[model samples]
Target chain A: RAEAKLIDGKAIAADVREEVRVGVAQMKEKIGKVPGLAVVLVGERKDSQTYVNAKKKACAEAGIDSFGTDLPGDATEEEVLKVVADYNADPNVHGILVQLPMPDHIDEERVLGAISYEKDVDGFHPLNTGRLAQRGREPLFVPCTPRGCIELLERSGIEIAGKEAVVVGRSNVVGIPAAMLLQRRDATVTIVHSRTPNSEEIVRRADIVIAACGRMEMVKGSWLKPGAAVIDVGINAKDDPSKKLGYRLVGDADFESCKEVAGAITPVPGGVGPMTIAILLKNTMEGAMRAYGMM
Target chain B: RAEAKLIDGKAIAADVREEVRVGVAQMKEKIGKVPGLAVVLVGERKDSQTYVNAKKKACAEAGIDSFGTDLPGDATEEEVLKVVADYNADPNVHGILVQLPMPDHIDEERVLGAISYEKDVDGFHPLNTGRLAQRGREPLFVPCTPRGCIELLERSGIEIAGKEAVVVGRSNVVGIPAAMLLQRRDATVTIVHSRTPNSEEIVRRADIVIAACGRMEMVKGSWLKPGAAVIDVGINAKDDPSKKLGYRLVGDADFESCKEVAGAITPVPGGVGPMTIAILLKNTMEGAMRAYGMM
Candidate 1:
């Protein structure tokens, strides 16, 4: 048995935040302005609220300006769109992000699409997503989680070019975009989901695996091609009364067992989670930089 | 060995073309004007000219007006973009497609992006492509070959939902779009490309397979999972001095051997090729119908 390397997402995210902090300072000094991000939160789902709060806090730490608006749970899509329109028109706001899982009454796509594409920092905009998948075309913003995964891989000193990579899920936000990113990097990529009859067999042959299917512990240790690098993007809450909250967060992979066979692995909570926030801030800063033609 | 059923793409395409013809006629009778498709050909390549002619002829058969112009091979990108802008403004034009493989002097994306998203019949525009990958959003047009692949499967009564489908390639035009389409149909899909280590092994487990890698005879019969349905989209020119043309067309799959083991398969010359033009006409008609609020 051999020891596996832990891909410390928190440490890598710290590196990114530091870079953004310095970059933000330089932009402010040279251009007399700092990057600014605006988030519109509709409905107060506890989880979504917590995520939004973290984003605002990250903006502060990275020397970027943050502005946000909170709408009631019963807010109409029109109301949300109105708030987004204001942010979209604000020249000071370099990036506009409407928090996801808005109340069911809201048409999420219409609201998201209404945000001017230039200010779509979340990278959920269709044009950006499609451009990211294209060869030779640059997307304005790469979705945060997928961007975070690539950051982890590159910062870990692992070679991505010409490697065999498998993405377990095909969600537009993560899995699909992640596969596109991998392909752009010259990795031969594959995607598998619930319908896949031989997911385990397909995964066991990967040089690198990205698990974003949101199924808790679905990928078992036995599925790992020994020494495969695994990046788990799933965040599922499993009931564990041992903690005061009566639940604990787990990823798509069976962490403890899979780590034994994986050459490198990221932990559930501290891995992909922090990297996402870091990338969001990075996108916001980059968007500002591009707007100023400084980069 | 028992003989395998041939997936007669030509027949399936004929069915689609007929449907479009009826749909177009109804539109003309009800609205007093037929849908129109405009093809902008910038070069004099014999193959590109032939393809353009085929598309115009299909448009005529389907009762859709065909518009085009043959520009010199040395046409500037600005010149091509100006032409696209004119078509974009013309109310009569419903679908605008720029013939691909434009002279090296012209930038494809610049010209394609110039077309109004509403009139982008090629579906190569970033917004349409991005929308296709999106879950709830329906794209105005899907890239023809990928759309044709789905049509072939649906017309033949092969179920896609909850099936294992493997797409061999990840090109933006065919491979990537095909994978997304299959996913939308509830097929668990995997994509394998040049960098894939075990493309054959991964593909062999599929209930359906789409080979769009453009490599001649890359898929072998030895790689088939018995009874798998195969769609061959590759169009490669292999040297064959036996003919006046000096080369013959072949697909990514080694058809003879694969068909022997597969439950059903499409032939190289007659399969996906005919379906592409058929889908293009279908898209043009549908786009016009949507514009008139008829569909």
Candidate 2:
């Protein structure tokens, strides 16, 4: 088999961000206001903050207005709900997202579900979920992570139709919708999760493997088809004694061996990671357009 | 390997119907109205009418009120939408199902989307689909065939959690949601469709194989994991010269050979067939209860 090309997710995501920047600028001029996204963070979890900062930075580069509400770790559920409720009714706030895994005391479901479906930029709203599952209807916002994965593939010129695609996870946020989106694109998809006894062997036969299992090194090179494209969605924190921070991020798949066998592959840190923020910005702009009936 | 047990879907569905019958009677007395399902047939297609008749018959035996609207073949999209709108507004109608493969003239997407998500008893509503896809939030109604497949397995005392389940086919109405439902029950799930080249080999490793490919005898006994439970959801009309209807219905798997290798297997016509309508009634009752806040 011929060697596979390395898929540059970072470059693709950068291009997407540039496109979003243009779209937002056009919409702002036509509509007399820029698309606005409001993100609420309940606590100062370092990772969540980094994600939020990246999202805000992306929004800025895309010419979309971004707002953030950071509450103390001890904030009550009602405190977060109040912020969400305020955004839900704001005409200027076209999209709203409450960063996940809030403090233990806050009821995450109540707060997340509180966001109106139309402004659910995070795509966690049941309404958006419904939209993804319904055959012909388009989701107001496909969840960013899954959407990013597909965007990476499409932007990379991978043909999904009639391909054997295996997704190694069943996460509602990523795996489930990723499978749905891939299947919608005509890929014959197989979703193998924790319950799968011989997941490695199963994945080895796929033409395309999407490893979003979140377990570091769960998918190795031997588990992939010789020329298969690999998209690793996991961003796991692994202990690295040599690092100044004492840890580093690694994907679910072992990249070293996988790159040797995979025909095309998305590297961790620089791969699917960047595309997620890009898609979030895109979804926000799309949400604004959809709300204005331009969709 | 030891001989497999053949699961009798006919008897299982019959048992389910009886349970629904009891529930329907109780619901009627408690709510002052029997659960009602309105099936809209947009044309004179014979196959559709047969399905409509079957559903109506099941509703009657279960003591649920049923209504049908059979429009002409040339009916406009608005005309069909009118029926759906009427059913949506009718307090008496607890569930609404528009027969599939509507005539060419009607815009099926617009018409299907027109049905109020609340009365979408077939669970085709995007909202319901989304609800079903979410982790903890259950749908108001799960689509019949998928729900039926799971119910059949559960009632027969089969263990779903921690089992390896392979679903053949990935249709929106059946394969996709069936896998999701199985995952909800803690089954490790994999979906294989037409594009799956090594489907038979994959099937042989599964503890539970759900065949919904709609192809007669495509899966053979060799594909079975010895002692695995098989759920055949395919209802294909094949050339059976001996049958009076000019053909006989068979499942995706070769039942005769499958029964020899499978621990339990449901036959084509008798297996998942009866369970489909049974689950429809169950969904309607559940929908009624949800709407009435009884659940």
CAPRI accuracy category, model 2: acceptable
Query: C-alpha displacement of B204 in model 2, angstroms?
Result: 3.6
TM-score of 1: 0.93
TM-score of each: 0.93, 0.86
Model 2 lDDT per residue over B159-248, tens place: 998888899987789987898899888787777877766788889878889998888888899888788999999888898789899899
- Model 2 chain B worst lDDT window (10 residues): B1-10
Q: How much RMSD separates candidate 1 from the native structure?
A: 2.3
Question: lDDT by residue for model 1 over A1-295, one digit each (tens)?
Answer: 8856999999999999999999999998998999999999887799899999999999999999999999899988889989988888888999999988888878887887888878889898877878887767888888999999999999998889878898999888899889889988888777787777778988987889999998999998899999999999999999998999999999999999999999999998999999999999999999999889988
> For every model in order, what is the number of clashing pairs?
0, 4
Pick the DockQ winner.
Answer: 1
* Most TM-score-accurate candidate: 1
Q: iRMS values in order, in angstroms?
A: 2.2, 2.5
The DockQ assigned to candidate 2 is 0.48
